[model samples]
Target: MENLFFNHGKDKLLWETEDKILLAISGGVDSMVLLRLMEKLALKETIFLVVAHVNHKLRQESDEEEAYLRAYCKRKGIPFYSIQWQQATSFGMEEAARNFRYNFFQEVMEQTACNKLMTAHHGDDQAETLIMKLARGGSLNSHIGIQVRQPFSNGELIRPLLQFSKEDIRKWAAEQSLVFFEDQTNEDTHVQRNRIRKWVVPELKKENARLLAHAQQFSQQLEWAEALISEQMEKEFQTHVKKQAESWQIEGDWLMALPENQQYFFLSYFFKKSLSELQVGAKEEQLLQLLRLLKKEKAQWQVAFSNEWFFKKSYQQFSLEKNKQVTDEHHVLHYDEGVYLNDREWIGILKNVELDKVPAELEQIGWSTFRQDFPKDLAKEFFLRRRRDGERLHLTKNLTKKVSRYFIDNKVMNAKRATAWVLTDSKNNIYGLLPFTLSYLSIMEETDKIHYVLLYKYRE
Candidate 1:
């Protein structure tokens, strides 16, 4: 009994001594047990108990569930909150309901002056999720199971009831003679989770007789394993995430050399922990594919997870960053030998005219020393910057046409062509334009050369 409560009741420590709790009650067995436990434990405390419910309007019985939950909370002297969403006649009911629920939880927490929110996720729920992931082929993150004290990247959201098993909760509810409304939709097999709950666990249990216990213990062990790995990786990750003048980059060579499993673990971990502030999870196939292919020297791969949310692999570097929106900014640069722009992370060089003097010797050199090759005869240099105002450039060497017209002459995307910057002469005429257009022919020339160097920028 001591182990049961200590193991299961450990989550209560997260609650503030004098703070309020905004519990998400579904009027189901799981939430009912949780509510009753809170009532029994916090009955004498000076904490406020607020009930937050999402009326998804999924079934005819949902209204009754809501009413019952309201009445139960009222009887216990706890505050109650309920919200109803009129969903459209579309699919993805679970996802829509989840969205509604989470948004409503945020609203209720804000309105009630509570920052802590608790859910009714138990060990059985965790086990079911693991088995489902296994059936579909588990990845490195699938084994994370339910988070005992989950938080958003900014430490805003949290889950507390993840350590206890549903059986333990059910037994506790029985001991207290607690009653909660039954959700008829839970019995409907239309949902994948329901099917797993009805058939998968029972069948597995019948085969092993102790499979449930094993799974629970195994999941705890996996949590421990994940903790040890994460602790070690954090030390290494601190050294690897470096910053540059313009962007962030993690090394491909060092990242590729890690052990296979650790490679998968750290890749996903590093991206979620260090890169985009959005949530990330690994599909085993996708993780394996990236590890196998990210080694190619110059090959590129790109995928858009969502609008403006994209990841790309180019020139042996994996770039996870926002999409660049081009702008119409006028720029000028004087004819110069060598120039540097912190934003472009490049050193620009132009030497005296020599048709056969290609810039081969500048390849794969350090940023500090690359500009030493600049010829002193044409030493005049000027700096360039990005802007979004009206700007124009010449299309040809004759300086007779605007850069926009040149892009139009070549049928380039107007949105993309608008962002072209140019180098100018001392008299404010176009000498050459920076590369943004597809057919701009901006490659480094033998006598006229420019080098873009990727420095160890900070990780996103």
Candidate 2:
């Protein structure tokens, strides 16, 4: 037990003498054994021990279990917390109960000023979780099993007993003569976890005598693999992605250029960063489809997620944001040979052009003609920025329309409209092209007139 504690609980130890711990006890054998071990080690003298139990009130014995835990804590001279789940929900009963239980545990942790919340998830539980997640079809992240330490909101959740198997816990409890409650609901085969615990695990253990040990080892290896992948993914993200106040973006071509595994890994990482959880079931498959579609160059595209998150691809940039009213954010850039906009993503290129000597290939290269007699003065006042409301472009002298109306008329998506660019003179006139309108400032007629043509390209 000491070896397992030192090996698995090193990160959970806040301090030598003043650490406060909140134990989530269910009056079950595993938690009872954990309590006995802590008592034997005299941890209560060095650190404050608080036991918390949540009664779902689903079973008739739940109240009795809570009472038993309370009595035990009182005898040990430790604080005990109990909360009842009085609300009713129709679906996902187990998930709802687990969420409520952890929430109440977190509340107790906060109220008592505890640094860590401990659980009794042992090796069997870890194996069962991995199997369930695999059956539910999750990525490698789901295969990581139960984490020994994970960030819970602001504090940490530590499960030190995960290194020990269920048999080990039971033996410890028996040696200490510990009394624990048995929830009869655990025997109901209708529950998937109970079915797995009663039938699947026992059969597997018969085949491999040390199945629990193998499962624990596999879980640790998966966790290490996840850590390594995350480290590499962070490096890639730092090199190619940028997080803004209202949105997150990645350079399209750079992201697409990576290997397929890295692409999936980074996209999964981004999804978690944005939504705080992995997209599961059919939604995860849809997200993968969206990621594939984003690799292509589409004029206007958008994908919506279940949690009010939106994905948009415009030109050569991919962006993700929460569903909210997005206001225009303006960024200014001067005209030069190559000027970057929006954190060096979109680039503006300027070159001297003579109307007579303009190459026909220039049109093929996406160069928009910006003919002006005072080319140098226009260049000095030229700046590229995001579109604003009430802005209009002169499509022709007689054809003028608001930019917002233009988007509406052309079926431009709201996601694309947020980051679309508009070129204007110092007076804020619209010289729109492409995502912006196709109208030029003016036509070129004079052969001797010196002009400057500007075009935009996404930097890879």
Candidate 3:
């Protein structure tokens, strides 16, 4: 551990900042080594340490680990924070425990005014994760392995030790004589990772002595592939993602034009953002199918990713949105109910109201309630659908401009224009396209109350 700290410990690399770091110490070998390294490096001067431990409360010895951590922190004169989670009785114990830990970490960080959090997930753990994900038929994103730097609530979560192997961590712990509690369940085959660690890994290692090394190589290749694909997808989004007068949109035509691999990565990026905001995962196939929902045929579709956000596939665009309880950066309002995007920017709503008897489903489309006082002539068409090729507006009945071209001329982002909902009638006539003007479109009849909702509920 002394040599490791002198040579390449996490303390020097990521802790140079004046951030109070909440170290997630499970009393496992890796975590103990992390605590010891911090001590050895004397990083506490620059980085305040909060030894945060969570008792999963699964095994009887779980609480014991918590006790040991508390005692160790007290002996070291370090402040310690702890949480006990009872929610693991649910089937998704790992996920549930993780969520609880993060929530607690955020709370503690805020209370301590901490700037970052650190975890000791070493390289071998990364390899195991890659193998596990592949064994479960992983996607490109899954193979990316846990990110080196992940976003936490207000600060960042740093995993500097991930570059090292489990053997490295063990050697460090042994050299430092670090005290840590062993969770016997780690050896249980009932857990998938344990089974892989025991039966699968050993057999593979026997068949090919460098299997771990090979897995490491695969992980690196996947990382590079992910980065290259992500770059291409970003360029595509740069070309396609746009903002119209109010609503945001993405060009389906442009997306479809990308190479198949690019399509998957771009769609994955969009859906993963939505999923992260909504707190959902592992729905690559489901989300890929959902991308079609962004075509011109549908004005809006909602998808649930747990409770953080609702994915909106509307107006030829896909986006992640938060619940009413969350703050809106654009509106800067609590935005609980429906909101007519202030300053004519956009309209986002959370209710299930139907406008003009448009056969509304729950939260699929925020139908605009046309006021009886509003002139029907003001609506080029009464039906609500995303803009399409056959769609056109009669500027003077003598000539027409493609809504797509009109949007471009209007300086609306191509991506946003593709997804922006345009009002139309059952006769397939253009009603009023949602404009990104500084104010309501002059076309919006003063007597009419346009109902628009930005947040869409997740589709079943």
Candidate 4:
């Protein structure tokens, strides 16, 4: 066992004498056995080792376990770092604890200048993970289970014990006379992993003695398949997808042109590569519904992707974007006092402006800039506000058009329509739609007097 472990470290991990490794120790049997093996390797190869422990403060023995590990590390003359998870969560405690654990491990790695983070995920854990993922249903990526090694933070996360099962670790620990804590929570079947570990895995192992090895082999095979599929998907993505700031845009026709299966694969690949932080799930139903919506006859449609994001189909263009949560803007305008319409837009009223000799800045204010003349008798105090529902604009002396209808006629995107401002009076009389159209009442003719000029400025 020792020879196999040493060879695995030197060959598979490619560990050198100068390489500093941060070990995530939980005081459990699996991690304790890992620490013992790493210590043996350090003695033989002179490799640097740092011990990091996270005290979840969930179990009653957590404090004791942390103190025991700290003392053990000190006795071995090894650097020890530990953190306590002070924030208690009511639900999803297991996942929350796992996140806190790895986060502390990363901080320790950074502080100690370690280039590798090691965890003790064994073959049994891998089998359980695969079973849980398969039963729960997810994309092929999820079924790949815990990886033996992957990039984490500034370095790599390595699970050297993945090739060994739990029984093997326990047996080796016994032979070495190592003292390790047994987490009682592992016996509680209330947790899905614990439940599967107690009943489902053992039954499967009975049918096939090499269940652990087979599970690991399946994971490696799936990883290879995913790589091949991803290579092709990336090429297709570059050809069909357009990235705009934080959002992603794709041609609807291009997506619908692909085979139905490829469409699902492409969408899955796009979400995983581009918007991974959003944690969008690859549910078959959700993807099928999106595909159906794309095939509909409607020119434009939108559906919520998540609470903070949405998928929009505008004409022939499909996009995934963050929901723009804009508060209704209503600012009272004063002469020469500029008010911000949005983050980059500024609007103000200028008095006594010559129509022929507009300010140089106003002259260069792009096409979205509104510089219309309004009769001084229009209102005593004019304000700028976002377009309200059921509002109408005076297009002619006897013609009126719904504000929503005007936006549709002009083909303005839903996002743009939300930010469009309306120039109005205290009595809610619409003066004009800034940067788009002027109300017939606000338009100045050669016969009508122009006293106030509404100036709009947009900063790039």
Give the RMSD in angstroms, all C-alphas superposed, for model 4: 5.3
Best by TM-score: 4
TM of each candidate vs. truth: 0.63, 0.68, 0.58, 0.73
Residue 375 Cα positional deviation in candidate 2, in Å, after optimal superposition: 18
What is the C-alpha lDDT profile of model 1 across 1-460, one tens digit per residue? Answer: 2245434544446665676778888988788877766675576556677889888787788898889888877887899999888974578877878887888888877777876787887766777888877777665555656655655322245454555666777777777777777777778898788998888877876798666567767777788887887887887677775544423456766776777777777766666564445554434566667677655554456655555645566544555555677544433333332323334334344333431232333333542332223222232543344422344554444445555556656654432343444544344443344453311222244764443321111111
lDDT of each: 0.60, 0.71, 0.62, 0.83
* Of 2 and 3, the candidate ranking higher by TM-score: 2
The regions of model 3 sitting more than 4 angstroms off are: 9-12, 17-19, 43-46, 207-217, 242-257, 270-282, 286-460
Better of 1 and 2 by TM-score: 2
Error of 4 at 263 (Å): 2.8
lDDT of 4 by residue, 151-193 (tens): 8988899989888999999999999999999899889899999
Count backbone clashes in candidate 4. 0
**In candidate 1, where is summed lDDT lowest over 10 consecutive residues?**
451-460
Clashing pairs in 4: none
Please, what are the lDDT tens digits per residue for candidate 3 over residues 2-105?
55544554444566646577898899898888888777556445656788898888789987888888888899888999988867655867777778888898
- Root-mean-square deviation (CA) per prediction: 10.5, 9.8, 13.3, 5.3
Q: Candidate 4 — which residues are off by over 4 angstroms?
A: 55-71, 83-90, 227-247, 272-285, 306-308, 322-460
Stretches > 4 Å off in candidate 2: 1-15, 43-45, 153-155, 244-246, 275-282, 290-302, 306-310, 321-460
Residue 443, model 4, lDDT: 73
